[model samples]
Target chain A: MAILDVRDLNKSFGGLQAVKDVGFRVTAGSIKALIGPNGAGKTTLFNLISGVLSPDSGTILFGEMPVQGMKPHQIAEKGIARTFQHIRLFPKMTAIENIMIGRHTHSRAGFISGMLSLPGTWKEESRIRNRSREIMEFLGISSLAESESTSLAYGQQRIVELGRALACEPKLLLLDEPAAGLNMKETAEMADLITKVRDLGITVLLVEHDMSLVMNISDEVIVLSYGEKIADDVPLAIQKNAEVIRVYLGEADA
Target chain B: MTRNRHLQVFLLIAVIIATQLATMLTDTQHYLTQLTMSGYYALVIIGLCLLIGYAGQISLGHAGFFAIGGYTSAFLTTYDLSPVRDKAFIVLLSRMGLLVSTEDLYGGQVLHLHPWAAFLIAIICTIIIAYAVGGPVLKLKGHYLAMATLGFGTIVYKVVLGTEGLGAADGISDVPGFTLLPGSEVSGKLSQRITNYYIAWGLVIFGMVLLLNLVHSRVGRALRSIHGAEDAANAMGINTGRYKLNMFVISAVFAAIGGVFLTHYNGGIGPSEASIMKSVRYVAIVAVGGMANLWGALVMGSVLNFLSLRGYFGSYDDAVFGVILIIIMLFTPEGLLRRDLFSDIREVFGTGKDRGERA
Candidate 1:
């Protein structure tokens, strides 16, 4: 069975169909790209799958288990973590603190024990802190650890967001515009990090505006237009789909 | 090399204690006695710090919980009102079925409690009531929550005013003096007030330590996270609703604990015990001190209380209070205490500190 299966998924806001009857399968350990022009419902679909928005009508199965009504955090607990398109790091907190919040799910001790400096809870705190630091080092933002989020450059913030999502230790990592504001060097680093994240025995699902990054790294690509799936195949094959070319151009024109 | 934060804290505490002891040795001074009262006020402000500073919740009904605790203990132990109000209520449900005699409620005299017992009982009852009210009250956000709790404070004040048995507008008097231990039996009316002053300050110290430990723990971090972003906190697996409720209970318990001391010190209970003005004063104390900072609350509470006693602002004390809040709102919105005095000290010591750095 596929790791992620969305069957007949649909969502609407008032009279507008934000996402319509979209179906796709993400096999385990694959870099699957959901690529579309802006407002092609790419994020809306991610939101639905990640439990941010309840599907008006659909079935989402994560490893054969239907996950429709789960809360966003619950979905995260079930091994799915996604970064936001607009970069929603807890802006006031230090970057490391932001990552530590993501590591909250892993902390075992209750508040009272942790605060009282109880014996057992201290170990868990250090462990979470170390893990967060490790993720920061992995993302090459270790130097930015003590910096406030808003102070950091745009690329660094994106990396911190990735580090936060990684702190969740999810089986499937969803990247929403991870390369959005990154320069070419930073974009390459992001691509390399995505490859490394996937190599760490995790499935990767990404939505990106950078066609080069999408066309280059994605093993498979799913195309959506006007909330409907127009194509689903290997990236090379998707690159030639006529409907996708037309939709892409049509969106660019509008 | 990390600036010895604890050393600074210990030094501050040592200095305050030394000052307190020196004042006590100087004994006959009226201002010193009032300083002790200021300490008690600071204790109550700690709870306000937790609520407004840590939880980012606005409470105008904390005085209600304070009064509930104060009157409960005072009236129950001193006046024998415990039988009708507390004990009778318990018995009516469990032991005696639904039928309760109104006569059984009446002769429960109003003022005769061992101050310590009253304090403990008041705190417990206040916590329970606060928890009960907080569960529903916290579900409402922003100003709505404030108004709901403000209404509760008003209700409590009105109850205290209307109930003639509870001293009415005149308030209770001759609240027996303090006994540090169970039966040490300290005497003389003046000495009793003095003893009460010390005990109240001691409780304040205890409350401060407890609150300090509380806000540094996991729950404190959760509260801080919620304050930063409610949606983000929930998405991090925190039940925001539950945390807010817990904060409400904690804040109320603090106020109630402070009330216990306040009641014993004043040797009285009245409608003003739960007045909105009292709660507003606390809110101001927390605000001026810096929300979320315990020391801020402590220092600000003591300072404000001391100034009021001196009639520093004379007839315009309330106005000065209002003006202080406005200035704080306009100039230093994060609060005076929230600005990190430790960092300031570091800078003063010629150490280059990382200001505006968040990581």
Candidate 2:
């Protein structure tokens, strides 16, 4: 079953066609990698799917419902949660508070009830707090729960972002350059975490530039170039594809 | 976290008790009156603190809401009526257990509403107007938002100054005091000073408790997240726009409540109450108190407003606020009593290093 299906998607910025007729499908509980060279419109594609930017023309079906023009929060409520290429944690808040904000959709306390501190509000708050702690522990950053997000190390901040996304309990997780600035050991741990996320029955759609991490963990790979889909296949086949070699690796070497 | 929260609540209760005790010991009517006025200002400052400090939104038109509230109550309570209509209304009010009698003035009749009724009506009107205005105004960011709200305040001030029915430049006068206990023959003017003092402080405490509860809840976390990163908050399934609007409306309501109480307590509503300087003073108080710290806003609001009431700044109150704001912005932008500053002060005193380390 496809958790996400995009068809004939297009986006433009004035004279620049940032994304053109791009399309893909991610099977439920599968790890899918979106790989391309710089300026291949990979991030633009992510933005379209996450509802940050609307496509000029396309259809995006998260399940059976079309989510083309939905707001970001609405899409998130529909079980689609995303992390940014640059970490966007709330800087002054503790790691636990950042993660708890991810549980917003799952809770229903509003202004009046929250002000009164009703019994139901307290119950929901305790539940969210416990869940936030569990997510931090799962990401191996439980000790950083009380630390401000900006005060954390780069790798730890990335982990905190992941924990925040996971606290949403998303059916589909969008990880944009999750291992962008990590060292070798941190990249390995991130790869392990991504696999664990898939094993937990959540579909993962990743945009990454790290070839080793992509080829090792991806059940399937989709490649793009010049805002167009170039290749879509298993990782082994993508490495052997002639067009991918000429346009991606050939250009890199030259 | 829970322990710190408990300590905060205990400290707040202690402060309330101490203020009441001090009022009794001093037995100075003038001082008590000044403190009561400070309580009114504190209400406005707390709301501004929540909007600017927690939600990261700014409003320079809170005095517009304040004016609206004051004028609403003033108009309802002090409107003159014909003798026949007044007599009929008096009979109706008496049947409803609201009025004991009606007073005659200058060959005409004056029918005053129950003070509580005027207060409720003012609040409801302010809420509606705020809801209508906040949707469009809250969308602008930063300084643009401030400019837009300033425009709103200026428009309201001009309207109140030009309208004769609202008393034009003279404003409405002789507003009635709140009757403490309902359904009694006694008038609201018998123990007006002490009654108004406690009522003002009581409302201030209630506002403080509500604000503290809000900031400690899940919704408060969402607001803090919006303050830190709006896009991130939106991505996390929090509706950033809705939260901002909600905060704006809530803050406006707080200002309105303060305006109503102050108008009744002062026995008049004036154009000066709607001045832009009044709103700026509120923002200054919140900034001096420390934007995100509730206690800081409360303490700074009360102390500074009380000082002004005591004629310390004389006629240069606005100038004093302007200088204080600039200094705080340049040197201690985090606020006068920021958490880190407290720790640093302790360090200088050569004690509580363990507490500093914990922070």
Candidate 3:
């Protein structure tokens, strides 16, 4: 099944074309990597899909539902969760509480009931706590549950961010440069984590600079340069394609 | 966390009771008047605390909401409708028991809307105004947000000062007391002093319980996340705009409630109540109380409002508040009553920490 289908998406800032007529598709439960050189509209495209930035004109179908112009929260409710290229954790909150926030889509205690401390809210809150803990355990960071988010190491923070997104139990997960600040060992662990996330039957679309990580875990890869798609194929084919090589390594004659 | 919270609430109840008893024993029951007034101001502070502290939004127009509540009830209850009493609609309102006939200063029977009706109208008006204003104002960030709310306060201040029917510069006077029950009415009567004190603090207690419940629940977490990082919260499925606006309205309603009760208790209100300085005082109190700490906001709100009401600062009242704001912001942006400070104080007194959760 085509879980996400995009067609002719366009975005611009003033006279600069940030993204132009880019389109792609991801099969359900497959791992896909969006690879590009810097300034190639990777983050902009990710933002468009997550509804942080609506495209100038485009159609994004998440399981046949049009989500192009929706707000981020609305998109989130539609089961599309994302992490930032830069880590954005609630600095004051504990690790467990950060993950618990991801369960916001599932929890429904409104203002009146929340203020009144209604009987039903107690049951729901404990459920959120346990489920958030379960996600942390799965991410293998359960021991850091009570530690404040700002106190965590770089790689740990990324994992906690992933746990937070996973706690939403979304059908598709968007990871933006997940392995950006990771060391070689942490990068290997992150690759393992991505595959594990894929094994859970959730579609994964990630933007990354690490070629080895992208080639290792991704079932399919899409390459872009200067706001346009240059190639879309399996990882081995992407590596062998002359057009993708020119974009990454630059023109040899020049 | 649960046990600590319950203990504090019980301690608050005990303190409220003990203070009343102490005043009675010392033959200084008149102090309860200022205390009662402080309790009302505390209502506004606690609400603003939630909005500014938890929601990470600043509102300098809270005093405008307070004035709206005060002026609306005052205008409704004191404006004589005797000249048009015989009209069909007026007669119908009289028949429906929404109108009251009270003796004016000259001993003439003046007809007006009942205080209960006026209070309901005031709250409804606050809600409408808050929703309308907050929808656009909360879209701004930082200094822009602060300036917008300050402008709102100035507009309200000017409206009340210029409008003749709302008593103009002199403000509305002779507002009838609100009767919550047959025997218990909100008034400045000496005999009912103790009851009024409890009445005012009881409302504060209720507000505290409600806010505490809110801050510990799912909505509270979402608000904290919004404060820490709005985009992240939105992507986590928390509706930031709706939450901010709802909180703005909720806090505005609180300010309005304080205005209503205090106007009834004091027997009149003035244009000064709606001034930008009053709003700044509230923001300063919240800052000094520590922005995100509910318990701190409440405690500091009561003590400071009590001192200000009792006229300790006198001519330098506004200046004192301004200085307090600057000092708090500069010296301890984390606020004065941090956990570390409490621990340090405990150590100085040689008292062991009450409870330490494992890190």
Q: What tens digits encode model 1's per-residue C-alpha lDDT throughout A1-254? A: 48999999999999989898999999888899998877889999988888778999989999978998688878877878888888877756789888887887777666457446577765776788899999999888899989998688998888888888898888888898889989999999899999989888789999998888888888899988888899999987877777887877354532
For candidate 1 chain A, the 10 contiguous residues with the lowest summed lDDT are: A108-117
Q: How many residue pairs clash in each candidate?
A: 20, 0, 0
Which residue pairs in candidate 2 collide? none
List model 1 lDDT by residue over B87-161, tens digit each.
655554435332222222456334244456566677778767888888888888888988998988899999998
lDDT of 3 by residue, A37-120 (tens): 899999999999999999999899999999999999999999999999999999799999999999999989999999999999
**In model 2 chain A, where is the ten-residue run with the lowest total lDDT?**
A245-254
Off by over 4 Å in 1: A249-254, B1-5, B25-28, B79-121, B139-141, B163-168, B171-180, B183-189, B192-198, B337-359
In CAPRI terms, where does candidate 1 land? acceptable
For model 2, what is the alpha-carbon lDDT of residue B344?
50
Quick one: best lDDT, which candidate?
3
**Candidate 2, residues A1-254: lDDT per residue as tens digits?**
99999999999999889899988899999999998889999999988888899999999999988999789999999999999999999978999999999999999999898888788998999999999999988888899999999899999999999999999999999999999999999999999999988999999999998888999999999999989999999999998888998988575542
**DockQ, each predicted model:** 0.46, 0.87, 0.86
Q: How accurate is candidate 1 locally (lDDT)?
A: 0.76
Give the B-chain TM-score of model 2: 0.88
Indicate whether candidate 1 or candidate 2 has the larger DockQ: 2
RMSD of each: 5.6, 4.1, 4.1
